[model samples]
Target: MRTKEAGAAMDSEFHVQCPYCGEELDIYLEPDVQGTLIQDCEVCCNPWKVEVWWDGDERSVAVSRGDGSE
Candidate 1:
Protein backbone atom coordinates (compact mmCIF):
# COMPACT_ATOMS: atom_id res chain seq x y z
CA MET A 1 0.00 0.00 0.00
CA ARG A 2 1.11 3.54 -0.78
CA THR A 3 -0.14 7.00 0.14
CA LYS A 4 0.02 10.34 -1.58
CA GLU A 5 -1.18 13.78 -0.75
CA ALA A 6 -4.21 14.85 -2.69
CA GLY A 7 -5.20 18.44 -2.06
CA ALA A 8 -5.92 18.78 1.67
CA ALA A 9 -6.50 15.08 2.16
CA MET A 10 -4.04 12.18 2.15
CA ASP A 11 -5.00 9.66 -0.51
CA SER A 12 -4.34 5.92 -0.41
CA GLU A 13 -5.38 2.91 -2.41
CA PHE A 14 -6.66 -0.40 -1.10
CA HIS A 15 -7.15 -3.55 -3.14
CA VAL A 16 -10.13 -5.66 -2.23
CA GLN A 17 -12.61 -8.06 -3.75
CA CYS A 18 -16.33 -7.58 -3.76
CA PRO A 19 -18.16 -9.91 -1.43
CA TYR A 20 -21.20 -10.40 -3.61
CA CYS A 21 -19.70 -10.51 -7.06
CA GLY A 22 -16.06 -11.36 -6.30
CA GLU A 23 -14.84 -8.59 -8.52
CA GLU A 24 -11.46 -7.07 -7.83
CA LEU A 25 -11.40 -3.33 -7.26
CA ASP A 26 -9.22 -0.58 -6.01
CA ILE A 27 -10.60 1.60 -3.30
CA TYR A 28 -9.17 5.04 -2.72
CA LEU A 29 -9.06 5.92 0.95
CA GLU A 30 -8.05 8.83 3.10
CA PRO A 31 -6.19 8.04 6.30
CA ASP A 32 -7.31 11.26 7.90
CA VAL A 33 -10.90 10.22 7.42
CA GLN A 34 -12.06 7.29 9.58
CA GLY A 35 -15.51 5.97 8.94
CA THR A 36 -17.66 3.48 7.06
CA LEU A 37 -18.86 4.23 3.56
CA ILE A 38 -20.88 2.53 0.88
CA GLN A 39 -19.05 1.88 -2.39
CA ASP A 40 -20.31 0.10 -5.47
CA CYS A 41 -18.25 -2.33 -7.48
CA GLU A 42 -17.48 -1.05 -10.96
CA VAL A 43 -17.76 -4.48 -12.53
CA CYS A 44 -20.69 -5.99 -10.66
CA CYS A 45 -22.72 -3.03 -9.40
CA ASN A 46 -22.81 -4.55 -5.93
CA PRO A 47 -22.49 -2.30 -2.92
CA TRP A 48 -19.90 -2.81 -0.21
CA LYS A 49 -19.64 -1.22 3.18
CA VAL A 50 -16.03 -0.22 3.64
CA GLU A 51 -14.46 0.65 6.93
CA VAL A 52 -11.25 2.62 6.99
CA TRP A 53 -8.91 2.91 9.92
CA TRP A 54 -5.29 3.26 10.95
CA ASP A 55 -3.26 0.48 12.52
CA GLY A 56 -0.14 2.07 13.96
CA ASP A 57 1.88 3.25 10.95
CA GLU A 58 -0.26 1.49 8.35
CA ARG A 59 -3.77 2.00 7.03
CA SER A 60 -6.32 -0.78 7.09
CA VAL A 61 -9.64 -1.34 5.38
CA ALA A 62 -12.40 -3.89 5.84
CA VAL A 63 -15.29 -4.63 3.52
CA SER A 64 -18.67 -6.16 4.08
CA ARG A 65 -21.91 -6.65 2.26
CA GLY A 66 -23.71 -3.33 1.95
CA ASP A 67 -27.40 -3.77 2.50
CA GLY A 68 -28.01 -0.18 3.59
CA SER A 69 -27.85 -1.14 7.25
CA GLU A 70 -25.50 0.15 9.82
Candidate 2:
Protein backbone atom coordinates (compact mmCIF):
# COMPACT_ATOMS: atom_id res chain seq x y z
CA MET A 1 0.00 0.00 0.00
CA ARG A 2 1.06 3.56 -0.66
CA THR A 3 1.80 5.78 2.31
CA LYS A 4 1.70 9.54 2.56
CA GLU A 5 4.88 11.38 3.46
CA ALA A 6 5.32 14.53 5.50
CA GLY A 7 5.81 17.78 3.62
CA ALA A 8 4.98 16.05 0.37
CA ALA A 9 1.92 18.12 -0.47
CA MET A 10 2.12 21.43 -2.22
CA ASP A 11 2.54 24.43 0.09
CA SER A 12 3.28 27.53 -1.88
CA GLU A 13 1.21 30.62 -2.64
CA PHE A 14 1.62 33.34 -5.22
CA HIS A 15 0.11 36.72 -4.46
CA VAL A 16 -0.97 39.03 -7.26
CA GLN A 17 -3.41 41.83 -7.86
CA CYS A 18 -6.51 41.86 -9.97
CA PRO A 19 -6.06 43.69 -13.22
CA TYR A 20 -9.61 45.06 -13.35
CA CYS A 21 -10.36 45.93 -9.70
CA GLY A 22 -6.78 46.01 -8.47
CA GLU A 23 -7.64 43.69 -5.64
CA GLU A 24 -4.85 41.61 -4.14
CA LEU A 25 -5.27 37.89 -4.36
CA ASP A 26 -3.26 34.89 -3.21
CA ILE A 27 -3.18 31.83 -5.40
CA TYR A 28 -1.69 28.49 -4.47
CA LEU A 29 0.73 27.38 -7.17
CA GLU A 30 2.67 24.52 -5.65
CA PRO A 31 0.99 21.73 -7.50
CA ASP A 32 -0.10 23.76 -10.47
CA VAL A 33 2.91 25.87 -11.28
CA GLN A 34 2.48 25.76 -15.05
CA GLY A 35 -1.30 25.88 -14.74
CA THR A 36 -1.12 29.21 -12.95
CA LEU A 37 -0.83 31.15 -16.16
CA ILE A 38 -4.39 32.48 -16.39
CA GLN A 39 -6.54 33.43 -13.45
CA ASP A 40 -9.85 35.18 -12.96
CA CYS A 41 -10.45 37.92 -10.46
CA GLU A 42 -12.62 36.92 -7.56
CA VAL A 43 -13.96 40.41 -6.91
CA CYS A 44 -14.59 41.72 -10.43
CA CYS A 45 -14.57 38.29 -12.05
CA ASN A 46 -12.45 39.57 -14.90
CA PRO A 47 -10.48 37.12 -16.96
CA TRP A 48 -6.76 37.84 -16.87
CA LYS A 49 -4.38 36.01 -19.05
CA VAL A 50 -1.09 35.91 -17.21
CA GLU A 51 2.27 35.33 -18.81
CA VAL A 52 5.35 34.40 -16.86
CA TRP A 53 8.82 34.42 -18.31
CA TRP A 54 11.98 33.43 -16.55
CA ASP A 55 15.33 34.52 -17.93
CA GLY A 56 17.88 32.34 -16.17
CA ASP A 57 18.04 34.33 -12.92
CA GLU A 58 15.16 36.77 -13.26
CA ARG A 59 11.43 36.08 -13.38
CA SER A 60 8.76 38.27 -14.87
CA VAL A 61 4.98 38.15 -14.79
CA ALA A 62 2.49 40.03 -16.89
CA VAL A 63 -1.26 40.17 -16.74
CA SER A 64 -3.60 41.24 -19.49
CA ARG A 65 -7.19 40.97 -20.57
CA GLY A 66 -8.03 37.58 -21.99
CA ASP A 67 -10.14 38.96 -24.78
CA GLY A 68 -8.84 41.07 -27.62
CA SER A 69 -10.89 44.05 -26.46
CA GLU A 70 -8.98 46.63 -24.54
Candidate 3:
Protein backbone atom coordinates (compact mmCIF):
# COMPACT_ATOMS: atom_id res chain seq x y z
CA MET A 1 0.00 0.00 0.00
CA ARG A 2 1.13 3.52 -0.80
CA THR A 3 0.90 6.09 1.96
CA LYS A 4 0.12 9.73 1.30
CA GLU A 5 -0.19 12.62 3.69
CA ALA A 6 -3.01 15.08 3.33
CA GLY A 7 -2.96 17.88 5.88
CA ALA A 8 -2.62 16.04 9.19
CA ALA A 9 -4.20 12.79 7.98
CA MET A 10 -2.27 9.86 6.56
CA ASP A 11 -4.06 7.72 3.96
CA SER A 12 -3.27 4.34 2.41
CA GLU A 13 -4.32 3.99 -1.19
CA PHE A 14 -5.40 0.91 -3.18
CA HIS A 15 -6.74 0.38 -6.65
CA VAL A 16 -10.31 -0.69 -7.33
CA GLN A 17 -12.14 -1.10 -10.57
CA CYS A 18 -15.41 0.69 -11.15
CA PRO A 19 -18.22 -1.84 -11.60
CA TYR A 20 -20.08 0.44 -13.96
CA CYS A 21 -17.24 1.75 -16.11
CA GLY A 22 -14.58 -0.89 -15.44
CA GLU A 23 -12.07 1.85 -14.86
CA GLU A 24 -9.47 1.40 -12.18
CA LEU A 25 -9.17 4.13 -9.57
CA ASP A 26 -7.21 4.75 -6.44
CA ILE A 27 -9.09 4.57 -3.16
CA TYR A 28 -7.54 6.31 -0.20
CA LEU A 29 -8.42 4.78 3.12
CA GLU A 30 -7.55 6.17 6.50
CA PRO A 31 -6.22 3.67 9.00
CA ASP A 32 -8.33 5.17 11.75
CA VAL A 33 -11.58 4.98 9.78
CA GLN A 34 -13.55 1.79 9.26
CA GLY A 35 -17.00 1.75 7.67
CA THR A 36 -19.00 1.92 4.47
CA LEU A 37 -19.21 5.06 2.36
CA ILE A 38 -20.43 6.24 -1.00
CA GLN A 39 -17.79 7.54 -3.36
CA ASP A 40 -17.88 8.71 -6.96
CA CYS A 41 -15.75 7.27 -9.71
CA GLU A 42 -13.34 9.71 -11.29
CA VAL A 43 -13.51 8.11 -14.71
CA CYS A 44 -17.23 7.43 -15.12
CA CYS A 45 -18.63 9.70 -12.43
CA ASN A 46 -20.69 6.82 -11.08
CA PRO A 47 -21.25 6.35 -7.38
CA TRP A 48 -19.96 3.31 -5.50
CA LYS A 49 -20.64 2.03 -2.05
CA VAL A 50 -17.34 1.05 -0.48
CA GLU A 51 -16.78 -0.87 2.71
CA VAL A 52 -13.43 -0.86 4.46
CA TRP A 53 -12.28 -2.79 7.45
CA TRP A 54 -9.28 -4.45 8.99
CA ASP A 55 -9.17 -8.21 9.45
CA GLY A 56 -6.46 -9.03 11.91
CA ASP A 57 -3.27 -7.75 10.30
CA GLU A 58 -4.75 -7.36 6.82
CA ARG A 59 -7.11 -4.77 5.41
CA SER A 60 -10.16 -5.75 3.41
CA VAL A 61 -12.28 -3.66 1.06
CA ALA A 62 -15.57 -4.38 -0.66
CA VAL A 63 -17.20 -2.26 -3.37
CA SER A 64 -20.68 -2.27 -4.81
CA ARG A 65 -23.09 -0.11 -6.71
CA GLY A 66 -24.33 2.98 -4.86
CA ASP A 67 -28.03 2.21 -5.09
CA GLY A 68 -28.37 1.63 -1.35
CA SER A 69 -29.09 -2.03 -1.89
CA GLU A 70 -27.00 -5.10 -1.42
**Backbone clash pairs in model 2 (N, Cα, C under 3 Å; residues 3+ apart or in different chains), count:** 0
lDDT value, residue 22 of candidate 2: 84
Number of the top TM-score candidate: 3
User: How are the candidates ranked when ordered by TM-score, highest leading?
Assistant: 3, 1, 2
- Candidate 3 wrong stretches, greater than 4 Å: 1-11, 68-70
**Structural similarity to truth (TM-score) of each candidate:** 0.72, 0.55, 0.73
Candidate 1 residues lying further than 4 Å off, grouped into runs, are 1-11, 68-70
lDDT digits (tens) for residues 1-70 of candidate 3 = 5554343253367678888888888888776667888988888878899888878755677778997654
* Candidate 1, 1-70: lDDT as tens digits: 5455443354477889888878778888764767788888888887888888768756788888898643
| Alpha carbon deviation, residue 7, candidate 3 (Å) | 19
Worst 10 residues of 1 by lDDT: 2-11
- Each prediction's RMSD over C-alphas, in Å, is 5.4, 5.0, 5.6
* Model 2 accuracy (lDDT, Cα): 0.61
Go through the candidates in order and give each one's C-alpha lDDT.
Answer: 0.76, 0.61, 0.76
Stretches of candidate 2 exceeding 4 Å from the true structure: 1-12, 31-36, 57-59
